[model samples]
Target: MAHKRFAQIPMSKRMRELCKEEDFAFLKSQPDQDQSSEESKLQESQTQKKLERDHRQEERQLNEQERQREIEEQKKVQCHAEKEEKWKSHVAELAVKREAIHAKLHRLREFRDFQKKVLLQDLDPGSTNETINHLLMRL
Candidate 1:
């Protein structure tokens, strides 16, 4: 019912009632508003691009750091393996030397026993076997 009465008013009077100085000023400045909006959108796009670029740079830096860490770890592993190899070789050499020394010691003991029984006459006939031995005579 109110809408019916309001519609009954003349269009010209409605236009005159709705018109205002501020409205015309706003309408006249519409082009500048559009330009400002475009500028703001361009700024936002540039800022977004910069943020994406920074994110990619950070990701690359992280990847580089990870790669460096992996390389360092590999180097450490390689160095450790090399050291282990050296230690194994050293241990093997030591084992060889020990076996050779044991063989030489066994030969020397056999020689000493032979000498005591055959070459040495009766230096101390009552003396028992021991590490230290003396011969009264030689062959």
Candidate 2:
């Protein structure tokens, strides 16, 4: 039982506690164990390197994605601002057109009133000057 417990300790620790003759004997008996331990250490180092490489690759991909997202956001904002500017300009153009149309309508109204007055005077030439003055005043 004590030997089993002793064997459970690591080989390096066991060698430290053992006499030189016993250590030599143990090493001779476990040549394959030492080789297997070296192989395991090599495997662990390779695995650690692979994990670090994968982590760096993942970080690069995340940073690239964030950069793309920022670019896309900038494009969206620029597009929105351009669209807003176009809409504002369109509204301003419409307001200008509306004002021009109102001015033309006012001119047409004045011309219509003048024509009506001329037609009335021609249709009733005998209308008194006082009556014409009263009608013009009412207009």
Best by TM-score: 1
Q: Which stretches of model 1 miss by more than 4 angstroms? A: 1-36, 120-132, 136-139
lDDT of 1 at 5: 46
How well is each residue in 1-139 modelled by candidate 2, as lDDT tens digits? 1356466666774565565567678767664654777787887899999999999999999999999999999999999999999999999999999999999999988976785688576767777767765766676
lDDT of 1 at 90: 100
Candidate 2's C-alpha runs over 4 A off are 1-32, 36-43, 125-139
**lDDT of model 1 at position 8:** 67
Question: Which residue pairs of candidate 1 clash?
Answer: none
C-alpha lDDT score of every prediction, in listed order: 0.76, 0.80
**What lDDT is reached at residue 100 by model 2?**
100
**Clash pairs (backbone) in predicted model 2:** none
Candidate 1 structure quality by residue, lDDT tens digits, 1-139? 1345467666674565455555677777565644777787887899999999999999999999999999999999999999999999999999999999999999988987777775335455656555235342332
TM-score of 1: 0.61
RMSD of 1: 13.1
